[model samples]
Target chain A: MLSSNPIKKSLNWLGRQLFNQENPAAFFDPLVTPINPLWIRGFTPAQVQDIITETADTKTFVLKPSNRWSGFEAGQHVNLSVDIDGVRYTRTFSLSSTPARWAEDGTITLTIKRLPGGLVTNWMHDNLKAGTVLGLSKAFGDFLVPTSVEPLLFIAGGSGITPILSLLETLEKDHYRAPVALLYFVRTQADVIGAERLYALRQRWPAFNLQVVHSQEDSKPVYLGEQHLDTIPGIKARLCYLCGPKGLMDLASDLLGKYGISDDRIRVTFFSAPAPVFTGESGGLVTFSRSGKEVEADDGKALLELAETAKLNPKYGCRMGICHQCKCTKTSGTVVNSLTGKVSSPGEEQIQLCISVPQGPVTIEL
Target chain B: MIKLTNEQLDALAKDLDAIRDEALADLGERDAKYIRKILRLHRTLEVGGRVMMPFGFIPPVFVAAVASLGLAKILENMEIGHNVMHGQYDWMNDPALNSQTYEWDTVCTSDSWRRTHNYEHHTYTNIIGKDRDYGYAVLRLSDDQKWHPAHSLQFINYILLTVFFQWGVGLHELETEKLRSREIRLRDKLPLIKEFFQKGGRQAFKDYVFFPLLTLPVAPIVLLGNAGANLIRNLWASTVIFCGHFTEQAETFTEEECEGESKGHWYLRQISGSSNFTGGLWVHILSGHLSHQIEHHVFPDIPAHRYREMAPKVQAICEKYGITYNTGSFGRQYMTVLRKIAHYSLPDRVRLKLQAA
Candidate 1:
């Protein structure tokens, strides 16, 4: 505590020297301070969990503690939160495995079926080995299953079977045994998920009818592969839920709208995102239908660029499959097979033209 | 991918050659007027018969006059003369004219300049990716463009100049780039010093460099005259370009929009995007009539001279399709663009809120 002025001065000089050495010109900006982590509102898979495969490409990931006790009434969904790289991201999956699973094991099960580039599903495939601890949020979504006793019709395309499967499970468990019709579309015999479980479900319940529409080169006429939906009978009284891509949903909308059904009665879940963009070789011409202009797009290019060349204001958003905001209706003609020689057939109704190419000529309702 | 069809290719080649021939014809006419004058001066300067003068005024007198007129005034006069000329290819149509190679070495024409000047330079002004006109972002020669590393200091210089001289910075920067262009050489350059009655920069450089340098002299008299001419011209032009682009009307391309291959949307974007300054002929020509930015962006191959004729056609097309055509008088749109620039360049949150509607 005595006066050691020179020593103190020497220490101060050293401190200044150190500071200057660390920062030249004292111009270093540490940038704004990062905010605290957001306790995310999306759903999470239970940490003490296991994915028991109910069928091929289908598994029930049991989340412990049921995240939320009662926000969902059956058809609602919980957005699964996952840490993608360093950034936390979330994806919504319908609660298809039923709330009853929570009674036995304090777990809410998500019957996830694999789809292309599905972030959470792909992440689960890669990292979710058994007994891995994870975080989850309580259920948070507004889509609720109807409690009405009307004939419930579910028209599912490919992996669109998830929510319907959950609804059926809930109906059977709750003793709501209402008459139901399901027309499930699959690419091949191998594409059907939860088929065995569904087969048992049909055998136990006489009121449930199941139709499998397959897309294959050779199939029986009575089998009626991927034929028109208008041929399906007794749709007048059924309360319908359509789930698939925008094209599939449009078909559902148009066909069902014909029967004088109000749009509110039909709940549609277009596949999580839009379809894959048609990739191609370099340099093909793009003819803007109404603009009287032709612009060039090279291979692996999106058709939206052609509008830029012609000076058109096309409405848009994330061109990636995420937003699905740029979905345009393809009026007629085929889009060039960006990869193989097959055009994107989104049903007979529409195509997300952003992901489609020009074949011969094409017109769009821009 | 952008290859021309065989017939179009042949037409393009022939057109290129014809343009060359036309430029030569114009040069031939200029040589006829200036060739004898140069010869007479050379002869007079050599021996005592007559006092030979290569230029109308001595180098010092010319410099003094230019200094009084100032760099801004000289630029204004040049800009006016250039505007009046307006890609003048009258010489090409003239039967009496010969090509520059055969006829003259002194004079140049607008048609020839179009290849080097308009086609290559102006068409690519300040484009960041392919074109090299990456001028400073601050006191811009063009509009808000992608920043260039080389221009950082130059932009600082521009602002400092402006702080003292108002638009002195802009005029100097533009004229300097214009004068020192590659088109000048020693043969054309050496005589300018004698014209200005000074000796450092030869005439072609003087025309290219020193003639423009006349705009930047330090003297008060020179600076004053330069101010009057440039302020008017700069205001006229800056108003035109800034209004056409900087307005609330114009929008930046999203990554989706930028990369989309759809020509219709691009057309719609340009149609909906750019603002047009409407009305008047004198202001139009002086401002380079760029309010038709949408048309120019859509069909860059078309000449500026043809734009006036094409404006209505373009407008009609937009109208038929129910496309919104944005047009406003000079002052109205110019302030709009200024406000837009200020608004957009703010923090992202502010810009996002403003743009969401």
Candidate 2:
């Protein structure tokens, strides 16, 4: 029976107030001790439970998030906010663990591939360890399996297999009785992330086919060509999900198009953009009006990255321009939208700082 | 004195921007340590004050306890609460210091304060019809504000506002002006009114009823002590806040002047509309670093201690631009603010004539 007694409710409120349970961490955080994860609210606090080295430059961080974190879908992404040297940085990554794992163990995994000179990724790989606490935004993303039971083809390269691994695990848990094949491309056998798990899945499920393509092992530069599509039965009928480096994904897309597959049958998630080319007009001055801070901003980097480099902590959510938390006033000068390749006029306007690059001398109210 | 051209203004803005950027870059262990230390001191003072309150049989002890408690409340509201709510220490990633989540030890709710203070006041500082903080919908502070007969007794209104400043802040989110003009329906204000009463009730209960009831043998002394402490805190907050933005040199703007405003112009307004007071480290913290009002206005999200460091740089830019940097000792600034409030109480034509005289 529901307790609708006013006396009980009043006592509960009194208890919360007395204990500061609404935000218990605020009372204890002044001691500089580790905050109990259960007390964290608003931004879900997660403790690093373990770090599994997947490859030489790749790691899967197992996180135990507080109760405030709602479970995520099998193929969704979450924004991880970490503080390094007193500066907080937020980066979005796919949750590589299945929802079932989260339900059973109350934990999630983020498989991160360290890029050369990458700030957050390198910091996590080197500095993050068990017992370190970080902030996490609730899971959000549209990339997921269709409701219809169509035959699946997942083409992944490098670290792009993280989300697919989650989908495969979910499929296995559900006992999905559909033909599914994964074409995972890596530099060599040692570079294959989650190879053992894929092999085990292939042995357990008859309909599941795992292909680990070693690009460097083949002298002729192994690439996804039309010849690879012929190997898959009913290639045109399969729903192809592509996630990888631009080169491999583009090749696979072209091959899929020639096979007369409908555009609706193809789904692609871009892990990273190719390195931006710096032209003569790339470098410019960015003025943060409020802070009285200005920096010489070079092209090829987003304004959010520049702001971080300048040590101006701006609020951000999904760094991919989906969450508009980093939107600030662009008071003067022009900036190019990195996502849309559009130039903003010099005037007062709101621009998403995450995806904006200064075209010339720019002034923003950060 | 020379008038600044748009180009000159932009340059001044850039110079000021450089200082802020440098300070932000310089923020590290020391700045974090400073805030944490202040927080610890505030907590210690509060606990000490509360514990000593029941021993009011001794007059000196009672006075000291009240003073300690008042100072603690002042520090919590100004240096810690206000600045943290401004996202000054958000980089620390400490939930306690988060601008979006930190609830102050005042009657006002943090969410309401964020909307009214952080968003409205910071965005539209000293703009006549825009910034509700222009006399906080009570007394007139500028000639742009049309005078009403009720303002004739603005001296009394000012005193009332000071005494009940926390309650006034609690009710600020309701935007009583909009309700008065019928721009906001009574129904729309219901939720805010409810929130105000709930928060106000909790505060009143804690200070007047709960704590006093606990000290049943000396309930009257406890109640009076709490009231006295609250009164002291409110008065100090009101004075510090008023001196910052309602001084003789603080300028108010029109909506037209603010239209399509550039970053440089925004900075210009913030500096011109904020007055500062000369003070030591303790005085600055007690004032919630509002003694560096110009710097605080310019970089609302920068930690308060950084404002003290940035003040001279900011003042130099003001001097270079031939702009008046309104600053004086606390007594002088507070008196000037009161005089300005009184000057605006009369009709605009009368005030203009007085100004000319």
Candidate 3:
């Protein structure tokens, strides 16, 4: 975009000469970041304006992004980069605040659920504080409200309520009078995220209805079924938005499908990558071309781990798929992306060693 | 020199490995912050030098500009570029510091440096025929090397190497020795030569052409200032590197002796072949912490800044193992390097002494 503008392009060229090929904005980052951490280039910088505990294991980060940051749609997700123990780790989270909030006051919020062994999420809960700077990617995702003004059915499980909360608020701000019902599934009432905000929205909006289902209730744990869908009025007519764990999404989609609801009428968003499928016959010999080392790869282990086990010190960082630090040229291979479950063609391609599982005999440039 | 028992060598290896592991485990925000601080300092000096170069009509300004610029280049090549390219701070995940892709502000490309320095020199160490870094295939610094007729003027060759140190380093991967012996054809060097020219050309254009042209009327002043800075950086780098590897006490091993070397024996070879110089914090930083060359040789991929703290532990381990840990003041080590250079300029020292008797 900077290059698209002639004046900026010329200035960039001049800056390259003055700063030994580094652009002026990036070259001055050391001086600028000390004054204002948000003044960095390449990525939008945000300051943690506040940290609010939503539940025992979930926290909400109120972020004030730099003015250079473009606002996000209500249900869009953003990749947030935080430097923990000197290593920069990036993890994506859905924006749980209304776009109107960001437009009015340059602040957005990401509600994160801490998993038992989640690296970045646990680090954020334990160490991140107000005033710490973070790198942010532009918002992306299509889990947005459809253009039509039909009645809406929202089914969210646990932290999946994050994006749903943003959509509900945005719909309320737009004064949508259509009937809207939310079936929020949580382990318990205390596990609810943004409970007060949801209650407040329901109190203000007459067309909205909220239901809390305790899936882990001692007396009777409730799971989504035909009985639940039958209770909502005009369920088949209303467009449904589903955001939750994989099992919940699969169940909800199946039930909706049986109810004569077309796939076009259902929107599903996954909060995390699905587990990559690996059969017993999946793995094969992996050849590191540079080192001339041949290793037998296990079914589901990433190339990076295999390299390390074979005494090859492949360059890596953030041992997760978020950082492309361990990407290498796959000269020949059929590999599967652990994050997206996408299979690569058996030819030359670049793949992230951290996330790719070799499907067959492969050769890679180490 | 003391001959370490195999058992003692194993214990020594364990001790040094423990030191390396301890330092590695302790790597975190401190190492990242240290590198960032050095980078900032380097950029500040570079920017300051470039800005002051046009005002070089004032003699003092000219000197100050050159000094700052030279220090900046030294910091970039040593403390920042050299360490980063060693995969020292690879955990940082910053693209600027990524070892595989980081290109320093020098004539030598990072790729070539990784192959020639990190791989060949580090892996083979001071093995007589294996590590060209022993004498850089020029001056004979060890008695094991056969003397050539050209050995007489090696003192001059050493000086020339120092003055144009960057070029020498940039062209090292070309294997001029192999080319001379016709072991390798010039055609095989085409790719390397192309890389050298592209990287070297860009470096030349930046300091000599672009910056000078930008300053127009004061072009010559800017040009001269840049050249002066480069000369200073070359001289400083060459002197520090020579002291680290060519001091009198540093031993050279024949390939036969190092065959299929075990981990303990490898550690022994590294300690025997490398030297260290004691200096203050600034001196260590300016040398890219190569002042702790022994620690570096033992753990080449670990962050160089940690070498200072690891030094005493390493020395103690050496004492316990009855192995030599060659270290002294920077001046003392450098003088010994000079002495070795001068002494090796003649034929075998033992033969000369016998002739004198």
**What's the distance in Å from true for residue A285, model 3?**
12
Judged by DockQ, which candidate is best?
3
State fnat for each of the candidate structures.
Answer: 0.00, 0.16, 0.25
Off by over 4 Å in 2: A1-39, A66-77, A85-87, A97-108, A116-118, A137-154, A166-181, A196-209, A232-242, A246-366, B1-11, B24-72, B84-158, B169-225, B245-273, B318-357
Q: Which 10 consecutive residues of model 3 chain A have the lowest summed lDDT? A: A272-281
* DockQ score for candidate 2: 0.14
Candidate 2 DockQ category? incorrect
lDDT of 3 at B67: 98
Residue A341 accuracy (lDDT) in model 3:
67
lDDT of 1 by residue, B218-276 (tens): 33333333333334444444455456555665543333333533334434554554667
lDDT of the structure predicted as candidate 2: 0.81
Evaluated with TM-score, which candidate comes out highest?
3
DockQ of each: 0.01, 0.14, 0.31
Provide the global lDDT of candidate 3 against the true structure: 0.85
Candidate rank order under DockQ: 3, 2, 1
Which model, 2 or 3, shows the larger DockQ? 3
Interface RMSDs of the predictions, in order, are 30.3, 7.3, 7.4
Clashing pairs in 2: A292-B16, A292-B17, A292-B18, A293-B17
